[model samples]
Target: MVFKRLRQALGVGGPSVETVLANPECRPGDHLEGHVQMVGGDHPVELTSVALGLVTRVAVESGDSAYGTMQEFGRRQVTDAFRLDPGQRYDVPFRFEVPWETPLTDLFGQRLSGMTVELRTELEVTRAVDQGDLAPVAVHPLPVQERLLEALLRLGFRLAGADVERGHLYGVHQTLPFYQEIEFFPASRYAGTINQLAVIFMTDPQQTRVLLELDKRTPGRFTGGDGFGRFTVDHATATHTDWPAQLDTWLRHQAG
Candidate 1:
């Protein structure tokens, strides 16, 4: 009897948790509304807290090697400490605000390759943490962001893949530890000059900043090298600008 009581006290049959998002689709600077549905186990348990976090996969460079791991960039508390009675059903609703720097996982109604974003649920019982299953969340691009992408496409750049890196970009102000890079394949028109490209977008409520990096296929002493440029403008200005023309001009200058 003592062994059985010990197992139960150790959270062996504490409680089961399942999180349900009202709508799993969101954009940066948007809100994720959901509820944490929980059921009491074989006996009553003391709950410490419940929370939600925005999580993504990031690539980390360790000297000569690189690896991928999951990281949470944002978190919000759902409920405080409480006692859960056996067979009781308790549902905690939440509205987690997605940060403006949150990485993108989807564009044009399609999921990007090598990209993933999910909501991580954590429940603590008497100081012992119990992590619930991850709930998938699809983060799409904002209007200005979409326009930037469309401009790249119109300039004949093919969408490749995207990944989050675990470091900072120089000269760019960022609140998050990691940033995302959207890669692209060069067009035939720029055949031997440009091999590949990567674009990074940083935006806040009022303005958007863009960084363009190119993998040049230069012939001389520089075989395959990288060149980059940056620009910042308000949302209205970004929407009005001719992206294809601007990007084309910039590419020509870098390729020269």
Candidate 2:
């Protein structure tokens, strides 16, 4: 009897969980609607709580070596204190608001090489917690963001890769702990002058602040330094501005 009790306490008879998102594709500042379907195990179990979180892999730097780590950026509790009878089934629906600063995982219908976002459901049994597999989610760019990306493409910058860095920018009002850097390789015209460019967008409902970092190429062994430029515009203004021209001016100023 004692052994059986111990086994149950250790989650041998815990419940199983499967989460389904109504739609896997979303944009930043949007809401994700989903349902958590659960089935009781062989025996009745007491559940402490049920919750969901948004998780992704981020690049972390330590002691001159950099490694990637899985991090949870957002979480929401779905339920608390539930009793599951043997073989019983229950469904819990949830509407989670995606943060305004959520990173983009897809562009032009293609997934970024190293970028991913997933929805994870966690079922808390007496003393054990079971986490479900990552439900893949594709986060697309906002309207303003799309315009900027299109402009860059028109200027001959190709998408290289993107990653989230595990720290705050030097002078940015970032609500989240990390920021996404969308990288691009310079066009043929500027290949000799610039190695690459990384862009970061800091946004709110009112406006977006665009940060540009240009990595210059050098002839000598010593690497060239990064040049920075910042600009702010409202959503309406973003659509009308001549981004390619403005970007060209910025690059010229940075290179000189």
Candidate 3:
């Protein structure tokens, strides 16, 4: 019994954990329901804690260079300390709230390129921590966000790329450490004035805030600078708002 206890303390053959999400797709400010299933190993063990975290890849700037790293933006504890016996099975249900500033991984039922969101489960043993398999999840855009994207598309802008950049946006209220930028190539009508445009969304339960950055094009060796425009709309008014016309006005004002 002592040898078995020693092994258990060392986490030589502790319990295994697997997380399953009931709904693999969700929008921002939503809840993801799941369960952590555990199966005992050769010996009984004491588990300190079990938690879930939302993780994604972010770009980090170092000196004059930048690199990619995995970052966890949100975490929630699933269970407290517990004891598991040999050959026993346990299931712990969890409902985790997805952050309001969570980045979108899917658009129009299709996964966006270079975007991924995962739920990570961590099991704490006496002397070791075992990480469960990552559960991939799709975070769709909110109704307001969807409307804005549709307006951009209607204005002849094509999605060039999207990425989550480390650091906060200037003059924006951000809960997460990173912000997502959806890049677009300017339409033919605006190509002469701007080279590209990028959109960022910061949302809450009440309203959705949008930031538009226009990268103006210049001649000679000097490149043009960025012009920013910001606006907010209530969730209820998103579907009824004239997004295309409003966006055109904003663009013209910025260009002028």
Candidate 4:
């Protein structure tokens, strides 16, 4: 009997989990749900609780390359303290409110050009120690966001690279700890007039903060071309709206 109980406590009976997406392609400010299962071991053992966390891999900017790192964005307890007997098992279900400003992993049903995300699980044992990482999940992007990217490409912006930088925009209300930056090289037509353009999309369910950083070449008069032109844009625009016209206007001003 003791051995049976020990087995139960030790999770020898195994555990299973199920996750459901209320709205997988959420813009931001959405909710997600999942269920956890625990089976009894050989004997009855006092079980603690179960937990789930949303995790993602991030890269901090170094000199030439990005430094890979991991961060936990959200966590929730799914089960209450309880005890399990030999050959007995229980299923526990849970729901989690995904932060409205959760980063986008994909765009318009297609995975983002360069981003990955996963959901991790943890199990609390009777001894207060936590065992986790049973599984991982993938997050994709929304349609409207895809359209915006298409527009940028259509305007001749070439994707240089992308990265997630920690901190707030100099002049924006940002709730998330980090923001995504997709950069581009000036198209050949504007290369002589512009150096490079960096685009940042700060988003929540309600709005997106689009910031444009333009570096202009300084014509050398007496000495040589020096200095650079820099600017930024922050507009509360919905993703569904057309942006090419406004973007073209911004690019023309920068080129001038």
The lDDT for every candidate, in the order shown, is 0.83, 0.82, 0.83, 0.58
lDDT of 3 by residue, 1-256 (tens): 0000111223557666666788888999999987887878888888899989999999888999999998997898889999889879889998999999999998876778789889888888778776665788889999999999989889998888788999988788888999998888998778888889999999999998998888887532224567877889899888888889999888877765
Superposed by TM-score, candidate 3 places the C-alpha of residue 242 at a distance from the truth, in angstroms, of: 0.7
TM-score against native, each model? 0.91, 0.91, 0.91, 0.70
Query: What TM-score number comes out for model 4?
Result: 0.70
Badly placed stretches (over 4 Å) of model 2 are 1-13, 219-224
Q: Per TM-score, what order, best first?
A: 1, 2, 3, 4
State model 4's lDDT.
0.58
Error of 1 at 66 (Å): 0.7
Per-residue CA lDDT of model 4 for 1-256, tens digit only, reads: 0000111223344433334333334444455654555566555666677777776666676778777677667777877788766656576666666664466665534555656555566667656554444343434433445556667777787877666666676777777677776667877767887777776666656555567666667653313433322232223434545667766776776566
lDDT of 1 by residue, 74-170 (tens): 8877898998899898989888999998899998878999999988888787658766667788899988899889888888888999999998888
Can you write out model 2's per-residue Cα lDDT over 59-130, one digit (the tens) per residue? 999998999998887798999888988889888989988888888999987888789898877777666776
Model 1: CA > 4 A from native:
1-12, 219-224
Higher-TM-score candidate of 1 and 3: 1
